[model samples]
Target chain A: MRYAYYPGCSAHSTARDMHESADAVARLLGIDLVEMKGWSCCGATSAHQTDRVMAASLPAANLLLAKEMGLDTVVTCAACYSRMKTANHEITSSADMRAAVADAVGQPYDGSVKVRHFVEILLEDFGIDKLRKRFKKSLNGLKVASYYGCLLVRPGNVTHFDDPENPTSLDRLVTAMGGESIDWPHKVECCGGGLNLTRTDVAVKLSSSIVEMAAASGADCIAVACPMCQASLDLRQKDIDAATGKKHHMPVLYITQLLGLCLGIPEKELGLSRLMVSPAGVLKALQPASSHQV
Target chain B: MTIKIKKQSGKSLRQTVEEMSGVDMSLCYQCKKCASGCPVTKYTQSPPSEIIRRLHLGAGDELLESDLVWMCLSCETCYGRCPMDINIPAVIDALRSLALEKGSKSPRGDMPLFNRKFLEAVKAYGRSYDLSMIMGYKLGSGSLMQDVEKFPSMLAKGKMAVLPPSGAEKKVVKRIFDRSKQAKGKKK
Candidate 1:
């Protein structure tokens, strides 16, 4: 299946591991993920914080590009997916918004282009049964806490994503890969993602709480679809330890990274070493660890 | 902080906010579901529901003076759970724009500044460059040493991209920013 991929700013920067692993998985699955060239940032929360129309306009620039490619758009960044979905919802549902967005984009913006997160594509478009058949190894004993941080599955009406409170797509994917996705309470908890840089103090508390909850639920590692969630949960352990006076190092891997590991793809392709938290613990959990030395 | 209602032209803030956010604050019957699910309430003086109540009460100056608007993560937990379907995060965005426009003091401080710096980077590079935006925020806020210790590790781990994102149609992004500014201007 062919799809236009929009890797938002963080995908290549803070969450490059996710980008790398996702690309590797796409190659393995033979899905044609055409990169949306000339795409700009989604403006993240910065645009919407000032004006809603501007938020739509920024993503509209990228959305129009996907439409130009004549393919449904797919994004690895939850923020980009959310922004694009929200824009599409608004523009398709409201004639006035369509006009304003078209005006802002310097041309007619086709807001009807479909946008799906890469995970959605993997689960819905690329069926789990098909994916399971491709797995060379299994996440046999791995207990992964699937963290679907905000943006991916909130404001359920507009996003029409999985359940806003307790999304099961990530969990279901992990389970399909022969991993036990622990039923964690903080599955859809807010990690205060956008505030990570500006409000580091808040990020520490929220990120720490997610880690704590996952550890409590006996998750060996946390799998995330969103870059910001991976960044906050993976990068902030030191700060969390400093603030909360608790030693913690929970492996936060992209969902694709785990899939890559089970597919028996080369570890370097997934950028495993680039991760902040060492996944050594979880990597060892895979039976015949020597065979899958990541 | 519970906004002390000073007058009853209450309709003005409510009307402006509803028009800007496209959310009817009157739909809220103080269900408090938003407040119950909001994750950041412990860090702030007011919860998500209070923002809606304040808007309904037309707590203009008092509302802007507080730090509530700048604190919303836009996580949309409140918006999702609201039995009345009130988009509290949109209301928060309206409140944030209003606060920034009025140059009101932020109790928590530096969030709005960071937002401006972030947008400025997006405008310049067509994508966010971390180092530049941090430098910009440091210059504006003077908290130069904050988050510096983590920089070396970020670079070592390849988490930080030293250069601005390229290949973007910069002129197009600039136009979007400019037109949006004008869009808000024409509205006011």
Candidate 2:
């Protein structure tokens, strides 16, 4: 299958490591992600919180591009995916929004384009059975706390992603990779992705709990699909420890990075070195003395 | 506990917010389900349900001055849990827009400063350039010394793109901003 891929602004900035791993995994999995010639930013929370017209129009510009390409839009960033889905919901539902987006982009938006997340595409479009068959190395019961930041599954009518409260899409993907997907209470916790830079104090208060909850679930590492969550948790991890008086050194890994490991993709190719928190210790403990596939 | 009462001008806060957000304010039954899921309640003065309550009571001035509008995460957790299907985040956005328009002094100036710089970058270039926006935010907010330690490591690890993003249609994006502003002006 093919899609019009949107590499959000974070892919070039804070989430380059995630972009590299996810791109490598997508290629290896035989899904063709065709990027458009000229794609603009989706204007994340800054647009949505401050201005309504901008919130819809920014995503509408990209949706217009995808519609022109005659392919559905696929985005890796959960925030971008949310914006695209929201723009579609607005333009399709209201006539005022439709007129505003049309006047903004200078193009009529009929809202025919479908926005999908990479993880969901892998599970739904690319069959889980096929993905499981390609797993070469055993996870050796490498337990993971599947972390879904808000956008991945929330405001159910907009995203239509999964169960808003108890999303299992990530957990299902982890299980397919021969890894143990642990059920943790904070799996769907909000990490305050929007307030990362401006009001980090608020973000810190929210992100620290996810790390603590992961440890409580007996998981070695946390897997996430959103860059905002990865950046908030991984980048602020040391600070979280310093502030909370906790000695936990949990490595936050992208779902794609974990899948890359199971697919036998080289560590360098997956950009594992770029991760702020090292996963060397966690990967070292992946093997048992018996080397059994249990 | 001290309760503050304030009188609002012509239109009730509920009518204005409902018009801007398209979410019917009367449906909220004060179930407080949204409060249970809100993450930043500890940091803000009001919970999600209480913000709605303030709107119902026509406490516009109180809502504008509170830090709750600035502290929302936009995580949609409250919206997901609300039985009335009220999108508290949307209502908060509307309140924030109203506050910005009214020029109410925000307790947290850095948040609006950051958003303004972020959109300014998008308005200029087709996509957001993180470096320049951060610099503008630092200069504007007078917090230049903050996060200075992370730059060197970020560059060495290829975590940041030093140059501005190209390949997007800048003129088209600029028009989007101009048109949006014009549309808002027309509404007002």
Model 1, range A85-180, lDDT digits (tens) per residue? 988887887778888988888898757888998888898999888887777777876899999988989878877789888799989888877789
Write down the worst ten-residue block by lDDT for model 2 chain A: A285-294
Off by over 4 Å in 2: A285-294
What tens digits encode model 1's per-residue C-alpha lDDT throughout B1-188?
A: 33687675545787888887888778889989888888888988888877777767767666876666787888998888888888888888888888877778854547888878889989998998877888888888878888788789889878889877797878789989999889868866
Candidate 1's C-alpha runs over 4 A off are A288-294, B8-11
Error of 2 at A131 (Å): 0.5
Candidate 1 overall lDDT versus native? 0.84
Residue A104, candidate 1: how far off, in angstroms?
A: 1.1
Give the TM-score of each candidate: 0.96, 0.96
Two-chain DockQ for each candidate model: 0.76, 0.79
